[model samples]
Target: MPQRIRKLIGTVLLLLLVVVWALSAMALAQGRVTELGWFLQLVCYVLLGALWIIPGGLLIRWMERPDQKV
Candidate 1:
């Protein structure tokens, strides 16, 4: 695939990923952490926030990978 096409697709995918991730996260946390202590809640939130980057990093690397010579 061409670089421009890959970038356009990557940008769209990233936006969709963010939207889905945020909504999924909120859904996962909603009313589920009410019983947890504040400190624990903070830790969970921090973990959740940072963990999404793993897959995103992989995707980005693939997206930016150089086109192979034919």
Candidate 2:
């Protein structure tokens, strides 16, 4: 596939990933994280906030990859 097309698809997927991740994180926070103590809650929030970066980074890498030569 062309790099431009790959990037366009990746961009849409990235947006969807972020939306889903945020919703899930919020659900978890509201349901379970709230029961934890303040420090643990903070830790959980921090981890959840940063966790999406892994997949997002991978997606971005794929999007930015040079097109394979024919």
Candidate 3:
């Protein structure tokens, strides 16, 4: 597969993941927000915000890889 294709696919998947992740996190936190303190809520949001980077970075790295010689 070409690098361009890989990058394009990765971009699409990453965007979908971000949207889903945000919605999922919000849904999960909706009922519990009142029970959790502000500090914990901030921590949860912060961690959720940053957690996607691991897979995104990995996909980007994969996109950046050179095609192997046949």
Candidate number achieving the greatest TM-score relative to the actual structure: 2
Better of 1 and 3 by lDDT: 3
**After superposition, candidate 3 runs with Cα above 4 Å error:** none
> What TM-scores do the predictions have?
0.86, 0.97, 0.84
Candidate 1 total steric clashes: 0
TM-score of 2: 0.97
Compared with the true structure, all predictions reach lDDT values of: 0.82, 0.97, 0.85
Q: Which stretches in model 2 have alpha-carbon errors above 4 Å?
A: none
Checking candidate 1 for backbone clashes, the offending pairs are: none
lDDT of 2 at 40: 99
Q: Estimate, for each residue in 1-70, the C-alpha lDDT of model 1 and write its tens digit.
A: 8776787888888888888888888877786775799998998788778888987887788789888778
User: Relative to the unseen true structure, what is the C-alpha lDDT of residue 40 in candidate 3, on a scale of 0 to 100?
Assistant: 93
- Candidate 3: global Cα-lDDT? 0.85
Q: How close is candidate 1 to the true structure, as a TM-score?
A: 0.86
Model 1 / residue 67 / CA error / Å: 0.8
Local accuracy of candidate 2 as per-residue lDDT tens digits, 5-56: 9999999999999999999999999998898999999999999999999999
